[model samples]
Target: MLSNDWAIEARGLVKRFDGFTAVDGVDLSVPQGAIYGILGPNGAGKTTTLRMLQGIIDPDSGVRRILGADRPHDVAHRIGYLPEERGLYPTMKTYEAIAFMGALRGLPLAEGRRRGKAMMEEHGLSYAIDRQIRQLSKGMAQQVQILGTLVHNPDLVIFDEPFSGLDALNQGKLEKMIRALAAGGTTVIFSTHVIAHAERLCDEVAIIAGGRVPFAGPVDVARDRIPAQVRLETRHADGPWRAALPPDARHEGALWSFPLPDTGVEPLLRALIEGEAGILSLSIERAGLHDAFVAIAGEAAARALGQPTQEEAA
Candidate 1:
C-alpha cells in the first residue's frame, strides 16, 4: 500500500492526443517535499505528464494523485505550475503579475501582494517590482515568472524547463531556490533535459524515453548499472604475450584494457605485475549518468534530445 503521506502518486497513467498516445503507461510516486526530476529529450511527453498532474489536461487512462488530491477533478488550489514556455502579461507590472497568480491559487489579494513583495525583495527583484515585464531583461523576466509560480505557496510545485532562458548566474540562483523550496516541505516535480541540475537538485529522478520511464531511482542506483572500465598504456608496444587473460583482458596496439570488477586498483595492479607489461599510465574510468543515459536509452534518445544528462533547458 502506498503511504497517504505521498505528495504525488500515479499508477499506469496514460494520455493520448487524438489517436496518438502522448504518454504511455507510467507509474510514478513522489514523496512529500522531494525534489523529484523527470528527464527526457524533446517530445518525450514530459510536459504532457505535468499538464495531467496539474489538471490542465485530463489523462486518457490510468491514475494520478497530486498533492493528496485527484487531478482535473477537485482541488486546484494546492498546486503551482511553471510551464516550459514563458507566459507573462507584457504590460503588467512584475509585482502585479505575481500577486495575480497567487490570487488565482486562493490567496487573498492583500496577502498575495505582501508575499509577492517579499519574494521580489528576497530574489533581488525589488528594483524591478514596479517595472513592466516587457522592459525587464530575459533573466529578470524569468525571475518574475518564478516568483509568480511560488507566490501561492502551494504544497506541490511543478516546473517544466524552469531554466529555459537565463544566464549562468541566474541559473545558479534558481538552483538554490529550488533546493530551498524542497527543504521547506514543498513537493517539487521538475522536468529538464539538463542532467547536471537533476543530479545536483533531485533526491530521486525518472528518465523518460518515447514517453515512458526507463530509469527511475536514486542517482547512485542509476550509476550502478554501468560497470567501470579502465584504460592502461604499456611502456613497450611490441611486447610478447599479447594473449588474453582469464579475467578477460583485451589489448589493441600498445593500449591494454584490463576490465576490473570495479574501481579497486589492486587487481589490475597485480595483473600488470604478472603480465610483465611495463605500465606507462593508468586511469580509473567511471561512467557518469550521461553515459548511462546514452547506454541505456541508446544514441537515438540522445540525438533526439540534445541536453545535459541532468539539466536540458538550463
Candidate 2:
C-alpha cells in the first residue's frame, strides 16, 4: 500500500461554462491508499471536478497536484480514469479492446495483452475474452471496460459511478476489487450519487452540493456533523416518559426519536433512564450520510433552482 501521505490536492478550483460555473471555488485532499468518495446529487459538479483532476477539462482557476506532480498531464501515465459515460469499440474483441486502451496509456503491447487476459479471468470474463464487444452482455462489456482501466496498473485511479449498471453480484466483485486496489497502494477517488456504496467502501468521503463541498472527512467524522437522532421503544407505550421529552422530539407509533445536539451515546441512555422511560429496545438511528447530504445539498438546490427541498417537496 502507498505510504500514509497526501496523494492528491486541489485548492480554489473553479470551472465555468460560459457564465455558468460548473464547479465553484472548491478544495480537496485525498491521502495515499485512501478510497475517497465524492458524493452529490445530479448536476452538483462531481463529474466536473473529477474531469479537471484527470486533465480531461481544465479549471478556470485553481491548482491541482496528483502524486506530487504539479500538472496532471505530467503524471498522465500513472493515473487511470473511468468516466461516468463509457466507450467501447463494438467490432473489437474484449481482449483487443483492453489492450488498445492500455497501450494508449503507453504500456507495451505485450504487457497490456498479458495483463488484460489475467484481468478477464479474475473478473469472470475469461470466457468472453475472444468475443467481440457487440456480442457480450452489457454487464460483460462493462467489466471489460473496467478491466481495461486497470490493465496498466495505475497508481491513482478515478471512477465515476463505477457501479452504475451493476447488479448485486457484479457490484460485490467491484467492491472487492476496489479494496484490493487500495491494499496494493492505489489512491482511488470515485464519484457516486449512491450513499450506501460510499458508506460501505470509502475511508473518507466528500459530500458536494451545488458545486460546493458541504462536508469532507473520514466517514465517522462526517457522521459527527449531523445530530444524533435515535429511536427508543419502551415497555410501557402509554408511559408518562413521553411528557419528559423536549417539545421538538418526534413520536412515531411507539418509537420516540430525541434529537441530541451531539453524539453522546452514554448521556442519551442516562437521560432515558432518568426520565423513567422503560427501555425495552433502544436503537440509535443516527442520521446517515444521505440524510446529511440532503440536508446540505437540498438546501443549496432550494436556493439554486428556487424550489423546495426534498423534505419540503414531500
Highest-lDDT candidate: 2
TM-score of model number 1? 0.87
Runs in model 2 deviating more than 4 A are 1-5, 237-244, 261-276, 299-314
Error of 1 at 263 (Å): 9.8
- Give the Cα error of residue 280 in candidate 1, in Å: 5.1
* TM-score for each candidate, following the candidate numbering: 0.87, 0.89
**CA lDDT scores, all candidates in order:** 0.80, 0.82
Candidate 2, clashing residue pairs?
2-185
Per-residue lDDT tens digits for candidate 2, residues 1-314, read 22225788888889999899889987888998999999877798999999987778899998887888777788889888888898999999898899988998889988888888888887777898789999988877888888888888999999999998988999999999999999999999999877788988999988777788877888887776677776777866764556556678777777777776354667667766877777888776666666566675667654443344546753
Q: What shift in Å separates residue 52 of candidate 1 from its native position after superposition?
A: 1.0
> What's the lDDT for residue 105 in model 1?
82
Kindly list the per-residue Cα lDDT of model 1 for residues 80-163, writing each as its tens digit: 888988988899988888988888888888888888888999887799878998999988888898898898888888899997
The residue ranges of model 1 lying beyond 4 angstroms of the native Cα positions read 1-5, 71-75, 233-259, 262-265, 278-281, 307-314
